[model samples]
Target: MTQTVPQTTAGADDIQEIVERILSAAALPPIVQAGHPALRQRAAEFDGQLSRDQLDRLIGIMRQVMHEAPGVGLAAPQLGIPLQLAVLEDQFDVDPEAAALRNRSPLEFLAILNPRYAPLGTGRASFYEGCLSLNGLQAVVARPESVLLEYLTPDGAAEQREFVGWQARIVQHETDHLNGVLYIDRAQLRSLSSNAEYAAHWAEAGISKAREGLGFDAGPAGISLD
Candidate 1:
């Protein structure tokens, strides 16, 4: 069952118009890039901000943009919509060795509203992460390996869930956007690499090799990272 947002006269129409504009194409649209004001501002909490039809339409467009970007997650701010909402999916056909190393697993599509998360423990992992908003570059970011997530479903029901491994990374990344934080803010600056460079060198070498070559320590030693 799909939940529809409550209609508010002028506000509903305004939000619907914005959503329609975003859905004008099925392919890529103008995703907000790094340094954009929208990406730097804290997003507002979503509370029936868009009418049901508009919300559903916006979600569909967002999914298309995310898939077209070939990204694991997307935040509303990336679309220049300052709302605490995001969609995530990680259905990539990962290599077996990489999967084992990162504990990577397939994640079904999910739409989360007003989401917040916190580290479940002190355990952390460092991995190269890229963003749709910051195309062509990736950096090593150390993040908690597990998180306790609290969010509202499209139906407006509250739910708390725990996510681990690569899935946890995706959750934290998306949630950080709502807080006006980017991965680069937490990344090891020396580990930044363009897509071409990463593919030509670091792709086969792994993070440890990347650390040695890039001359950046991820963090305190002995942290069990993949």
Candidate 2:
């Protein structure tokens, strides 16, 4: 017999309450913080039928949570939904070197649906990483500095793009959420340290090992450990 996944509904009040809690929390919520049990249990396929109202609300709530927590990206799973969705914002001001590496205008925010990602190469770089879910902890995790990704837009349009530098890292980080993985799961113990310590170490080193493995230089300002 073929297994079948249950269809689920996205409720307004329920999701709104979670969003509010996330905004008010002193820190980012734990992994799978809010949303319906179905949302947390397992997400259904997108079916290319999200209403504008639904998309708007999800975007608004995600934006608020990201602003409050000051993270570069968030995934539906972070909000307790297993959907193949995410939002990303590059808030840092661009440095010339960073911009050249990305080869795209700085993006304010992006909404992704049903994403597929592939590393550009086998090489990896080490950067201190943190998550809203883990709260007050950071670690040095290896990630690809560049990747090629394909995903759907909120409107169901197919989108394919290559990301480099910080953008690539951000995409990889969020995509991990879709697969039930966190940065900490891939972190190195010695590399995991306080934000200040990580900063001092990176400054002393003057270049991120993460970028070097990818054949690039350090990120514009380096990855924020906060």
Clash totals for all candidate models: 0, 2
Candidate 1, residue 176: lDDT: 78
- Worst ten in a row by lDDT for model 1: 1-10
What lDDT does the true structure give each of the candidates?
A: 0.80, 0.63
- Residue-level lDDT of model 2, residues 1-226, one tens digit each, is 2223333455555544555555566764554432335332334345533456666667677777787778888887677754667899976665676456444255678998878788898766655677777666676666776799998888779999998866887888787666555676566654555666555544322235534432443222222221
RMSD of every prediction: 7.3, 8.2
lDDT for residue 133 in candidate 2, whole number 0-100: 72
Residue 180, candidate 1: C-alpha displacement in angstroms: 1.2
